[model samples]
Target: MARIIHRLYNERAFRRERVIRDRSNPLDIYNDEELIERFRFCRRDLFELIEELTPDLEFVSDRNAALPPSLQLLIALRFYANGAFQNTVGDMVCVHRSTACRVIRRVSLALSRRLARYVHLPNEAEAAAMKQQFRQASGIHGIVGCIDGTHVQIQAPSENEYLYVNRKGYHSVNVQIACDANYKIINLVARWPGSTHDSRILRESALLQDFEEGRCNGLLLGDSGYPLKRWLMTPLVAPTTDQERRYNTIHSATRSVVERCIGVLKRRFYCLHGEMRMHPERVCTVIAACTVLHNICISKRIPLPRHHQPLPVPEEDVRPRPAVGIEDIAGRLVRAQIINQL
Candidate 1:
């Protein structure tokens, strides 16, 4: 009888604690400014978005004391902002490690569904406007978007891990991103392993098909790693003439936008800056989530984090090629036409 009475008392205490925690406002812990600094979004805005996608009701039973939607969003944002482990993030928000993991997965999945609304491939009219903006910034005509690939480091996978090892002697995901002048991600393809070549990723992408079908107008600027195609423009192998040198200079500067975007992205989300310890598939979802968040930050005009800085792009290696090929001829003819206008 004493034991039963004790159990009843403990249950009541636990219920009381849940009531207090749920009623407690997170704003008391951190003001709007502090909340924005801690997580990238202001408290009001973040709560509204989370509330829209996730109902206010607890995901788990009230007995389990599931986290509020606001706390769930906060925990996930802190994870993305710092790339800290589950335990560390949980401690920050007063939750267990396992609960932290569940919260992050749930929030990531939720945000990823809204990716289409945030990140999109430009339509014909949008592409024209983007190209015009690029021309105004730099006198490069027929340029639609800049294309490049960055290696997102990841832990060795369980199966055929060797395939994930890149030339840099590390496991990574080779992510291809296409951005316009405003650094908005027009298209993103990130399913390939690190060992995969940048050119291969592009060739396998739907964007390549669009170019081939002439559905995508204008040219895409890429670095030496990609092949010279009718739609894709790469720098000259050896620019002997003054005009060729000027063209290469302009091409390098214009293409640097994609590199800059990659830098900004990694800096904003530190998870991509170093090796991420997660399954390959989960890593892909996280990468997509970060991309969507990056776009949201841009759309909302949110200021970058205080310590944010871009990562430096590595230098490219030289590659041998055929003296003369059909693709080479086509690339040169297109270049010659652009140079004449210059």
Candidate 2:
């Protein structure tokens, strides 16, 4: 009886010593507009996100006082919104720095897992509508999407650190984004290192393969860094004639859709606006997850921040690559045909 009583007392003491951090409602401190300002998600949108992510984020066991899924999301969003230190951001919700880091990764991964649902190539009907929209908006016919690559800065990694260094003389991951006329990201490829060229990133992507096989309809407009494939159009490097110059101007303007999408993405998620201190792998995951969230915000018509954060460094590095390989004759013919039509 004495030993059992002692064990019970020890158990009670241990329970008392364990800490359960307080989770406050951000809505209490910040009104709807203020909350959106801080976290970039209005309350209604936030609740919708929380509901969507709860199934993946909620813990099965309540051990050690697991964070409420809503709190977990808020903590992650705060990190994403401002790119502040983990501890500093976590303190807003009374979680440890480590806990905040883990939560950010968790929430990022959760969103990334659902990336296919949010980001994807347009289907048959969707593609037809997108083609018309692109033509109407840019005066460039048959443009289904615009593509570009942006370098996301990151802390030096443990393995192959040299490969992460970009021409801007910094560490980063080169993320390729493809967006439609409306600045909505349709597809994203985020796994490549910063040293990888924009053309190579496209050359090796399944997106290119799908286009090669004629799986998706319409041409994709890209900057000169990409090859002028039959399905991918690049502006003429030397346009001697007025019509050629006009085509170049139109191509540049049409391709700027992807650039604007990148701008809005970084503007919305400041974490991508600056260097991310996580590992390269985590950085990739975070980028993809952010892309997914960016699409959601675009669909819901979330207002872009009034102040534009500086866009990512110019990616059309050093004009066209020196070794662009043999030009695709078929691609040249396509451009010429479009030029005549124009």
Candidate 3:
């Protein structure tokens, strides 16, 4: 009886200590500047966001002490900023490798769910503002967003491995993004396999449907890889006149913002630049989470890291598709009209 009581008393003391330690940890050890350098957010903001994410990241209050939410956020941020191996991040955060993996996955999923509100395309009025901004920046009229596709490398899957292998002979996901004039991503689609063509992905998206139904306004400027439509504009394949040539030049300059956005995204979240070891579905979740964080940085006016350079995108073979509707013809006429004006 005495031994059992002693054991129970010890257990209670341990639990009390752990609860106090967890509560006091973030406050005592990490200052605001240290938090910013490590997690890329001010300490107060990080703590508040972690508090909000508690419902998703919190584990059952079992006998074992669970890791604190702030610590989990720190692990996720470090992984995102450095793209380090799971064990490496574990060492930095003083957790087991498997625990670090769980923390990252859970935190990323929670962020993607709660933070997606900031990453969407603007509404009608906001889009008008976006168009005015683009026009002022590049003298391009009615341009809502710039569209492009990039390959995010991933490990070869056990099933459907060939489908993920891109034209560059590597496993990847062909991520499509549409960005505004300020280099913020307005739309993103990342589930497609690397082997999927850029044009097919855009054609199959809900954004295309919205544009076709006239629910959305403004045209998306894309490179030659995208199909020209009433709502989506591409540079002329072969410019025969000076007007067409001038149009292409302006189109290239304005559309390049999407490329820069992608570059900044990869630079900010090094995980995208590195070969993601997670499954494709998990990778998509991570991508979504990173995009949300990227928008947050833009909203807060966080300065980008120096020496971050945009990489060159490969010019893929243009795949022509049959345009059956009046929309295509109308788009061609608009292009011609714009060229004539130029």
Best by lDDT: 2
Ranking according to lDDT, highest score first: 2, 3, 1
Supply candidate 3's per-residue lDDT for 43.
67
Give the per-residue lDDT of model 2 (tens digit) for 140-236.
7788999888899999999999999998899999998999987889889999899988888887888988898988988999887788888888888
> What's the distance in Å from true for residue 193, model 3?
0.8
Q: Lowest summed lDDT over 10 consecutive residues: which window, candidate 3?
A: 18-27
Best by TM-score: 2
How high is each candidate's TM-score? Answer: 0.86, 0.91, 0.86
Off by over 4 Å in 2: 1-18, 306-318, 322-324
Model 3, 241-334: lDDT tens digits are: 8889999888877887888889888888888998999899999989988898888878877655445445564343455433333347778888
Instruction: Write candidate 1's Cα lDDT for 76-157 as tens digits.
Output: 8888887888888888767878888888887777777777787777788988898898898779777889999889899899
Question: Which runs in model 3 stand beyond 4 Å of their true positions?
Answer: 1-34, 306-327
Give the range of the ten consecutive residues with the poorest summed lDDT in model 1: 16-25
Error of 1 at 274 (Å): 1.5
lDDT of each: 0.80, 0.86, 0.81
